[model samples]
Target: MRTRQSVCARKARYASAAVALDAAKVAGLALRPYRCDRCWQFHLTSRTKGKWMPITSLYS
Candidate 1:
């Protein structure tokens, strides 16, 4: 599990939940992409960070 300081709790939880739900929809013996919980969390963190930084920089 890669820890990124910029990640927040809410987004991480949401990402995890979404990923789990999606995985359930197609959880039948397959390991191609391997887009599991961790991947989803990392993606969400980076995406959120990407969206947040630019807007925040404007005010500072």
Candidate 2:
């Protein structure tokens, strides 16, 4: 059972959440690493509200 969401399918996929988070960190943007249900991979999103945000110096 493999069905990739259109929004996620066309986007980059990270093998792990750490990798995704690191990529975001390098980008120097406050991005949230979330596990995609459709792709079963990690993806970054800018939507921070109601989402877990890392209490790091970059975010702070």
TM-score of candidate 2 to 2 decimals: 0.76
lDDT of 1 by residue, 1-60 (tens): 554445433432424545644553465532112233443442222123223344554464
By TM-score, who's the top model here?
Answer: 2
- My TM-score estimates for the predictions, one after another, are 0.21, 0.76
Global local distance difference test of model 2:
0.80
lDDT of 2 by residue, 1-60 (tens): 234578887878999999998999999987878888887888888876776555684448
lDDT of 1: 0.38
Off by over 4 Å in 2: 1-4, 54-59
| lDDT against the true structure, each candidate | 0.38, 0.80
Residue 22 lDDT in model 1? Answer: 57
Q: Give the per-residue Cα lDDT of candidate 2 at 43.
A: 88
Lowest summed lDDT window (length 10), candidate 1: 29-38
User: How much does candidate 1 score in TM-score?
Assistant: 0.21
